[model samples]
Target: MNLLYKSSDESATSYICDETGYYLIRLQSKVSEQNYKAAYSAVLESAKTKPYQKIILSVIDDDENPLSVPFSARSWFASYFSPQFYKLAQNQVDVGIVKPKTKLQTNMMHVILGVVEKTNIKINAAYFDKEEEAKEWMKCPT
Candidate 1:
């Protein structure tokens, strides 16, 4: 995994794995609007950097410094980011999300993925408890 972007506060880090053709965005705890956009900019850049269409989104809980996603950030993602991203990928991207530890985080994933589905993008997305499993799943044809 090569580092593509890291948040200023180190709360988020995005990686690109050329081997798996998967872009990984690992977010720790809370997601502020600024941090979300910074990380998403990297995602857009990654799509432009290569035709890679797989994404492994991992949201991990940090017992030491727990944070939550703000409503504004979520709204921004649903309203602005998802549409642009899907359009850029031509609705061909497959996203594999590593399931988070807490119920709240898990619910966040549902909401985000749900919003993505509501966008009417023909993308495949699923949740897994293990990252490797998600990667394997991504390797299969949808």
Candidate 2:
């Protein structure tokens, strides 16, 4: 597995990519609407070349804040790709792994997962736990 790291002003600390069709995104701060959009854009742009089979987003929320309106609404209207880049990827990508740090927040997780499910995205799996688990999941075959 070949992993590369990139930095963004958003919550994410690094973006890891492997030639085997998987991406692991590690978040370092609380996720905000603006940050989410930026991260999504970065990931989407990267995906154009890598064409990952799965994307594991490791969200670490030390504050456990409620989902922002834009993010929630984007999840709600996820069917249309015009709003969120993540949703756009969901339409074509093979899998989406959303991992929340510590004990997962059910509502936020559900919202994202529901959007993925509703969109009929081929999610190999989803998880919420330590960063290691997320990384391992991203490496594993679907």
Candidate 3:
């Protein structure tokens, strides 16, 4: 993977390339709401330049803490009803991938997959017991 951008704090890393089609963002730490927003913005900016077909996010919880209640709620809402982002993703690129590790990670993954299934979005996804497997899956074809 071609490293397009690396966060100064080392909390996250992003890669972009023509072969991949979209920016691949992998968070190496337990991302806070602020961090999430910043990552989103960064991905958006990269999208403008790279013009990828989709975004594949691979996030893992560095602390192994359960998804915060607020984060889970927000993610569920966004996955189901975020019309603006969904529309923006419609033609530009699709967003898909595994959720960060949390107590509710499995449930959240199910919810996300259900949303993608219902919406007819071509989101390829999987769960990994290890980050290496997740990375390999991300690089492999659906």
Q: Give all candidates' CA lDDT scores.
A: 0.77, 0.52, 0.55
lDDT at 87, model 2: 49
What local lDDT score does residue 126 receive in model 3, on the 0 to 100 scale? 52
Per-residue CA lDDT of model 1 for 18-92, tens digit only, reads 887778888886667788778877887777757577788877774565557778887887888777777777668
In model 3, the clashing pairs are 66-103
Q: Please list the residue runs of candidate 2 whose C-alpha ends up more than 4 Å from where it truly belongs after superposition.
A: 1-10, 28-30, 63-98, 101-104
- Arrange candidates by lDDT, descending: 1, 3, 2
User: Which pairs of residues have clashing backbones in candidate 1?
Assistant: 30-67, 30-68
What tens-digit string does per-residue lDDT give for candidate 3 at 1-142? 6775566665566676566565666665544555555555565566555555556666566355443324653464356333333454554334556556665655665765676567655444455566455555545546
Report clashes for each candidate as comma-separated counts. Answer: 2, 0, 1
Tens digits of per-residue lDDT, candidate 2, 114-135, equal 7657655555555545656655
Q: Write down the worst ten-residue block by lDDT for model 1.
A: 60-69
TM-score for each model? 0.85, 0.64, 0.58
Model 2 is weakest, by summed lDDT over 10 consecutive residues, at 76-85
